[model samples]
Target: MSRESFDLDIRIDPERQRVAKQRAREGRRLMLLELGVAAALVLGFLASGASRRLKAALLGAGLASPWLLVGAYLGLVLVGYALAMAPLGWWSGYVRAHHYGLSTQTLRLWLADEAKSLALSLVFGIAAGEVIYWLLRTYPDTWWIWGSTFLAAASVLLGFVAPVLILPLFNTLTPLDDEELVARIRRLAERTGRRVAGVYTIDLSARTTAANAMFMGLGRTQRIALGDTLYSQYTPDEIETIVAHELGHQVHHDLYQGLALQTALLVGALYLAHLFLRWGVARFGFAGPGDVAALPLVALAVGLFSLVTMPLANAHSRWRERLADRFSLQATGNGAALARAMTRLANQNLSEIDPPRWAVWLLYSHPPLAERIALGSEAPA
Candidate 1:
């Protein structure tokens, strides 16, 4: 397609844009609602003396070891939290997606996925809680520093393993059989002075129609993964542009940059949590920072900290996304194709071309669709 042939105005469907806006709005509403519910639950647990009672009951049951006590407390807390949140999870994850005609998952499949997610969360959450409480007990005054460091290390470790260990649990990933396309992508990587382990297609169509492409893993594990919906629907040039964008993330080391950002945020949040714990000790008569009953305070602090900092993190993310978009245009030298691809993606993925400015400021992690399309249209080939 010629540069002049791609008309930005004509490519957008008005009805689709309307649906996109509604979906986006509702999605954000659901997120905020979930957060509110979580905060309320934590506060209720503390206010009602439920957390204290639970900890006391466990201790009275002859759970003598601190490790065992922490484990049991976290397990019960996590289970209770999960049970409380399950209704909202169903509404947001399953019902809402189905209502929007976005989800292909049946109730059974959705439940199965939720089960997997809950199991993973329990394992990780309990493990992290144990380590954290241990640190609190051992280093009451400076546990935040050590805790943040451990959390930072864990984040990076997850980054390296998630693509291989975690992702495969949810979706089947197999090598893309399109030999010609694979070669084209390899050449694209080569042109950027990089190599990929392989090109794979993920089973996105099984769950949702949202098209996406990503560079997965780090170092020797690095590979390109194209959503099946993307591979089946988009043209080679369009896919090339999308893959180029993912490559930009790799080339710019955005993953490492993100980890660094996360480490900073963790330190800040943990410090805030420490302060909250100290206040809980004074106000709520908690034993100390190591008190299991004060866990809710730690959660409330960390959650509030994350909620407050979300906009700043999102702004940083938007900057990276803009850089990636620029890289895609420069690397592919197919601005027209990129524009067309974004147009199709907006429609297919139900993205609002020009979202409200407030949403852009507070929620968006990428430049709005209209801006990306314009960038592609204006790029010099």
Candidate 2:
């Protein structure tokens, strides 16, 4: 046989090929199962008179006293957290990550991390709920509108605070001190007219194998954070590309835009929630707002709202991600490097190369790797 023909005969081991295909199938199956279960839960809530019961409970509790209403809400949140932790926290978050070779955390460490996150979430959730309740009382005629506005303001406040206050609870963050890499990144930031206050690195590898880089904070506190795994695994050029992409988010004001968009969405959702709560209470024979028995009603309403809005939110996020990818390519002038970085990150995370369209539409916050790479390559060098 000719040398050319022999070279073309490269083959994959049959067993390895089978395993690869099986893994792909399994990933798709799991994705579908997750979405399906979420949808079923949302539907069940709507059908089961859950919303009405919760509204009645909330109303009764609120009428009795503001403190009573707050207590009832906290109780509901604790119960929901307990239910979610068993499956999502214990089994899915811990067991599945370990089973898939993605996690390096011990069970004790994982539990500790989960507890911290739960506490933070509870605090934030309660604060936000109290604000919403106050707004509802203040503007009984337009509770939804006013409530949404309050929620949006709270969300932005949280965003600004998360990197500085909340994030440190789970992982150690240290200022990036590698002189050579810092010099290169600072140079890049200067060229893009972005100030480089400092670079930070997170010990994400302590928990999961996922590789990521992010631009956090706003104004003087604004900084970039790179996962340790990213620094260790990727080349300098690849890291530059990733950093540049993150910087793009800052340059384009994506963070602020995202906050605004989310606020608008939440306002709409609150208005819809108000409408639905009234109907739900009537249909489900709820006991009036503050009743503990009405917790399920509230859960079902919120769950359904979130589920229905997933596709829209995912699409918006994907658009921002694509824009960032393009900006990165332009900033770094290295499409191939960015592509390589993306592929490496995906492989490290065991991400599916071509997830089902519906799944991607519903769940993905970033464009698929292939599309990102293609856009990067097609951009002017």
Candidate 3:
């Protein structure tokens, strides 16, 4: 939001720092609020003996038809989750962006987007849950392996289609009109030996001031996209550094690596879910994992697993991110450009330049800005 603060020197803006600290505080609150709400829903459902009633209600609602049953169950679950998450979603997803002067959305527009998201999630989640529950019902003993494999495939499929299908639902994607930057990007791609399909710009200024670029899609959909915010707020050299960094991700096959690692994590998480479900259904006197009523328990299992694994995942991510930084430096052979770009990006995004060590260990998926800046200034081999 403060384009005037784009300075190469590491000068601190007191006002921006104040807002960033406030944002951080509020962000922590949002995270804790979300976690508490999720846990409360899970525990409250379990404790209030509501699960059985919901299951029975679904049975009656779906008594005459199979589609009716799945529809009723899925509808109830999705709507319930949406209702529970709405307040926090507004506070974090909508209000916070406005508070930070990052958002350009009206409340009505934001709510409409939220509704569309809920609808999309409901459709896909129900479809997937139906098959997953069917697997659990048919192969209780070995469902974890099959379910995980299915999920891994689904994840890949989502990534493949997301750029082409889902992205357009929220924002308009258009070609960047800056020929000079586009040419530089093409040259960078050629230097990296990657044939990027095209470079496009997403209309991010309509929604937020956050600057971002990424290499997404697979095969035909593979291309680089820069948020419009980036171009408006950054110089050609800075954008080039971001392009090189993202291209480094593609050259290193980080996407596939990330997918594979996530799949591995899913397999383990699902296996643990199986164990938890087995113990839970017996102890809590609930229906089997296939029952819609027990979905909350499933969520709990996966959620807890992710929480426990957060630090490890963050560490791996930060390591790979550093590798990407080093790759960018090597490819560009302009450490000063990279460092200055990194600095401007941090200032533009109002990123916490140097977060607490413990917070970085627990939740950060990328290395601290200071560390990344240092990488650009690393001595040549």
Best prediction by lDDT: 1
lDDT of 2 by residue, 1-381 (tens): 001111112222344334444665766566567657655655565476564455456776555676566656565756564564356446567777777777888988987877777777677767766766565556645767777777777777777787888788887778976777788888888888856546788888898877888888766667789999777777777888998888888888888888877887786666666666666556656544333344445556666677788788889989998888888888889887777776666566666655668768977898876677566556666
Predicted candidate 1 versus true structure: per-residue lDDT over 220-330, tens digit per residue: 677779899788777788888998998898889888888899899999999999999988888987888999889999999999998889889999999999999989888
Please estimate how well model 2 matches the true structure, expressed as its whole-model Cα lDDT: 0.70
Candidate 3, 1-381: lDDT as tens digits: 233444556554566766776777678777988999889988898768787688788787655454556567777878898998898889888888887887888998898899999999988888788778888878988999999999999989988999989988997778877878888888887888867657788888888888778778876777778888886777677778888888888788778888888998998899889988888887777757666667667888899999988898888888878888888887778787777776766766778777788889998998987787777767453
Candidates 1 and 3, the one with greater lDDT: 1
Candidate 1 TM-score to native: 0.95
Models ranked on TM-score: 1, 3, 2
Q: TM-score of model 2 relative to the true fold?
A: 0.83
Question: What is candidate 1's local distance difference test score?
Answer: 0.87
C-alpha TM-score for every candidate? 0.95, 0.83, 0.93
C-alpha lDDT of residue 218 in model 1: 71
Top candidate when judged by TM-score against the true structure: 1
Q: Which stretches of candidate 1 lie over 4 Å from their true place?
A: 1-10
